[model samples]
Target chain A: MDTSVRSKGTLKLMIVDDSNIIRRRIERSQQIARLEVVGAASNGRAAVEMFRRTQPDVVTMDLTMPEMDGIECVEELIAINSEVLILVVSALADKATAVEAIEKGANGFLCKPFTDRQLNDALEELLSEA
Target chain B: MFKEAEIRTFIEGTTNYFETSAQQSATVGSPYLVTDGNPGAYEYTGVIGVTGARKGVVYFTAPRGMLTVLLMRMQETDTSDENIKDLVGEVANTISGNARRDFGKNFVISVPVVIAHDLEKVTTPHSRSFVIPINWRTHSAKLVVCLE
Candidate 1:
């Protein structure tokens, strides 16, 4: 395991976002920390499909996706599997959206323009969730 | 096709996007015409295209100095070309997305493009449109919505 990160397992993570910046950030963070980035999707619908195929340990979702959007994705993801840990990573996940995600069964909230530490912390929290 | 409400929503949405994502406190100004497309002092200007109810472009003009500060806030390292480019372009894209969400599913947004504006030579016709300036610290950005 990389000293910067605490895990070295084949734990998969699905990054869902339309912006290349976000996908790259999550992927890069995973690589630097040596985590397995299983898949990525540009929209919510695609993310759902990716989730089923990858069966990731965690999901980093962006709220402002075009087709299905984050809130809807959260709803769908939770309905499909409530045990999955979902961390919203978006600049648009404001107070209302954060509350909405929590209500919809998201594991945690992450405000965008965040650092790798924030990302790591979110994943750790999710991993600890039951 | 852009309505007064749209322009207002765009400005507000853009403001919220930057304020939240960039972690910068934006000094918002009232909406006005873009008398000259070029304003303030900066070497690079980033613009995001907006379509649908209105056919026009939204600019996130940042003086390099301002961009540096924004980059500093967006990431841990102060100097990453990828991060800076992504930060500037994504800022515009995100603001436009927020505005589009308000406009319902009718609007379509284009990829973000950052242009290096020669402050000394760039001339945006005032008659075409005057801009509403939103100053952020040392950097000033404009949100101009020219109706189609």
Candidate 2:
């Protein structure tokens, strides 16, 4: 992924995580990466709702949520807009679930406890692809 | 029975979660086997059940002060009891999830169940737990792993 391209035009992004701390961390990291966090949700249900309302360019989703899991949300979002870019940012890093999510239509995956650089790179890679 | 490598993975996960997520460096003390008795007491605890190849439980316990500091650093102004409980569960979930990389798909971890208070009686009778002492910024916590 090319990290040098500093496209200042704010890329609307949505962060989905059950933990308030994780969401805050992602929001803070996105600010550093020059990505605009237009929406934040604690679960997949909220994620889909917010995605429709915000129409974000990219989404960072977390699996194992209470209401709806990230894989289902990925499918829902893809159904809503086939071109939507969804990145699974989850603590559950198992390859089985990762492959399942990809099959469900997630654009990429980033495991939890990620650094700012990793988050930025994933977002940038997703954005570049889009 | 739990393997040494599995214990090491859980320890590494705990340390990494604190350092990376909360920006707090966690130093793990010597791990002792807990055949009986509780793994100390704390204001909050996060317990998760593991299925598949490993069938048992994993938990993280910490005081309110430590969790409050963590929440503050995480940019949360509301350090209420509910949020603190939620933070503890999230921490445990992240740690267990990190360990999944080493344990693979067979080590299926469930969502965390947060408990606020009376953690002294909590015990896994079926398996001996390895209680790992973790200290972060003058506050202390424990990561308990019991598997069969």
Candidate 3:
């Protein structure tokens, strides 16, 4: 009945990935959750650029991308803002990869082929920590 | 050489990916003997390198339409050709990751690799591979695997 998170300020978020499809998916899904999309970036470099500009509350990032990879992106983003919630949205096929993201200051991971419930769960998991 | 529980998990997890990602259910069927025929009718081969106890490949091959559908699921939307390549690589990775859970936490999984082609490309080194017959609702395909 009350899906609107009830937070006075919206969940300002950013999505960085090489695929427009994935961006659109996160966009549409978060639209239902009503998260405010600060903006989107096509690659890691753009992600860093937008991060500096928007300083979003959360970032849904992909591990593999052009101009830079997700791991590298996390490394850079971490240096700038260690407090930001960076949830990896990736197709990395190994637990180590997931572990790697977390080790690199990422807040959590969002495995590919995830359901909307999963997306929400990971989001809530990170948000709950906040 | 997979235990019943392990194989069951592989089947269920991979099937879940197909259902939510591919928007189709995998139809259970006979074991597709990889040595008997080809992988599928794809213009590219979706592969993830395997190492540690088992060293080989988890490969996926299918037509663009079928592959496109699977890719769309992975990326979570209908995309153009530029995105399709990325989606294929990611889907292959996701499937292998799902299957990796069956190997328990002892084995290793590498990054997904995409080789554009329609021919059967063998993963050599004389390693033993497992062939999982994946049925997609009405259609079926072979998931070629090996354990070093």
DockQ winner among the candidates? 2
User: What shift in Å separates residue A31 of candidate 3 from its native position after superposition?
Assistant: 2.9
Best of the two (1, 3) by DockQ: 3
Model 2, runs deviating above 4 Å: A1-10, A32-34, B125-127
Candidate 3: tens digits of C-alpha lDDT, residues A32-89: 2536888999889999999999988789988756678888999998899777788898
Off by over 4 Å in 1: A1-11, A16-55, A61-130, B35-41, B117-130
User: lDDT by residue for model 2 over B1-148, one digit each (tens)?
Assistant: 7876668888888888888867778899988887764556588889888999989888899999999998887667889888898889988898888887888878888888887887655666464688889999999999988888
| Steric clash pairs (candidate 3) | A63-A70, B27-B135, B42-B62, B43-B117, B129-B145, B129-B146, B130-B145
Q: After superposition, how far is residue B66 of candidate 2 from its true place, in Å?
A: 1.4
Cα misplacement distance, residue B91 of candidate 1 (Å): 0.8
Candidate 1 residue pairs in clash (backbone atoms < 3 Å): B33-B130, B33-B131, B34-B129, B34-B130, B34-B131, B35-B126, B35-B130
- What TM-score against the true fold does each predicted structure earn? 0.60, 0.88, 0.73
Candidate 1 lDDT over residue span B1-148, tens digit each:
3445557776776667667546666878877654445444346655655566656666566666676787666553634565566566677666665664456444556666666645554333233443567788877777555545
Q: Which ranking of candidates, highest TM-score first?
A: 2, 3, 1
Residue A116 CA displacement from its true place in model 1, Å: 9.9
